[model samples]
Target: MTSTDSTRSRWIRLLILAVVAVALAHALDGVAWRSARLLSVNDKDWGRLLRSMGYLPTWGVIALGFWLQQRDHPQRSRYAWALLLGPALSGGVAEVLKLLIRRLRPNPDVFEYAFRPFADGPLSNRGMGMPSSHTLVAFAGAAVLAQLYPRARWLWYTLAAGCAATRVLAMGHFLSDTVVAAVLGVAVSTLYWLRWVEPLPAP
Candidate 1:
């Protein structure tokens, strides 16, 4: 296929995935929320820990550590740059969407479609659900790192998945929130990697 055709095809696939994700979110919100509630009753602590893995400080430290360790390596700069920038961009985008969309967190009192955009002002912390930021950050980091370190792609993606699961397990977001965020995170990081980091040398 021509480059233009390939790009169009990719966009079409993404559009289809978005449609499917929305449908799944609507159909499975109750089931997903209930399952999470059940599993998290006994595993809330574990879920919190996994969620922390995606926090800025947590992954920032990891990326910085890799950079420090690979100072003499050929792709150290690229790894460092991609790891830091990818997650930052992903999380930033998620945060903005959370504010703009302002979907309510999954709760017994609220259904999956609840929204309260700017209800408490732009800086409002309430109802800032949908597109779990934790998942986005985790997956963005995973996508970039996996690309840079292909051998450990499974490990990276597994950790990212754990991060995504934690959002549901904690009742912090609906299933759709994490699913969409996972896709967005990977898309953002992959695009960034392809446009900028892919040309860099790798060890």
Candidate 2:
């Protein structure tokens, strides 16, 4: 890490951060401008089906992955922990931000999505839709898995893309919400890898 190398790295990091910020802003704008017209009129059921596919099921997937990894690669159990943490922490952050922001979902009268919580019968709960927690968790989990198994990067990324698309199709989340979720997921996973997972001893 010479002075020149350090400066270059800093510039690259800053450039990436700026790009992420712009992408997030664009996504948020899309969410704010979302409308029912985005759904297809010809086949509503198909849209709904596509949306349903995006559901991440964070806990079950993480637990299952951990269990399988422990059984198959006991020496690499630490990687499983790292994999699990990405979704867990990202979801936690999304949930807390949701509470604080109190943005409403597309369907205020009902909760149809996987991440939808029980309505507390309050006005504050009416507009609670900013960042898509499901999308964030889905991408986070995907990214962690991809990092752990570089050979399967395409598969993990495909899953993440499906999750993001489903969020919009299901009408459970706006495009912006899913977009921000994706960004957050990637950011969290990247930070974890650079700071922790990458530094671990090889198996």
Candidate 3:
């Protein structure tokens, strides 16, 4: 197939997968949430600790540490480009979507369908749950770290999945929220990597 055809095919597959994921999440959101809650009934503290790993600031700190360690290495520039910018762009896009959708969190009183599209004031804790920012950052960083450290890709993905799970376990977001974020995080970060980070001249 031609390059154009190959790209089109890839996009088509992504669209199909996204549709399927949304449908599945819609069908099993409550079931998945309850399962997570049950599994973490006695370990919510662990869930909270894992959840912090997904925070955007935590990602920034990680990238900073990586940069510090690799600064003298030859791939320093490339690592910096991918590690720093990938998660930032992923989290930024997720934030925009959150503000646009304004979906509610899975907190005690709120239901999943609660939304306030384009509301004026700042988003309260109860809202802005769609395409979770934490999951986005976690997965985005994982994608970059996996590429940079190919041998430990599984480790990176496992941590990212753990971070995503914490959201549901802690009732911070629905399963659908983390599911969508993981998809978007990997997609956006991969695209960013290809478009910008991948083209840097090797040192």
Candidate number of the best TM-score: 1
Candidate 3: the clashing residue pairs are none
Global Cα lDDT for candidate 2: 0.65
The per-model lDDT (C-alpha) reads: 0.81, 0.65, 0.78
**Hey, what RMSD does candidate 2 come out at?**
6.2
lDDT of 1 by residue, 49-130 (tens): 6777579777778778888888887555777878888999999999888888888787766564777746468776556677
Full candidate order by TM-score, most accurate first: 1, 3, 2
Model 1 scores worst on lDDT over the 10 consecutive residues at: 35-44
TM-score of 2: 0.66
**Which of the predicted structures, 2 or 3, would earn the higher lDDT when compared with the native?**
3
Residue 39 error for model 1, in Å? 7.2
lDDT of 2 by residue, 64-130 (tens): 7676856676656667766677777888778777766565666634533223344553324345656
Pairwise lDDT winner, candidates 1 and 2: 1
**Pairs clashing in candidate 1?**
none
Question: Candidate 3: lDDT of 125?
Answer: 33
Model 2, residue 74: displacement in angstroms? 4.7
Stretches off by above 4 angstroms in model 3 are 38-49, 73-75, 107-112, 117-126, 201-203
Candidate 1: misplaced stretches above 4 Å?
7-11, 38-48, 73-75, 110-112, 117-119
RMSD of 3: 3.1
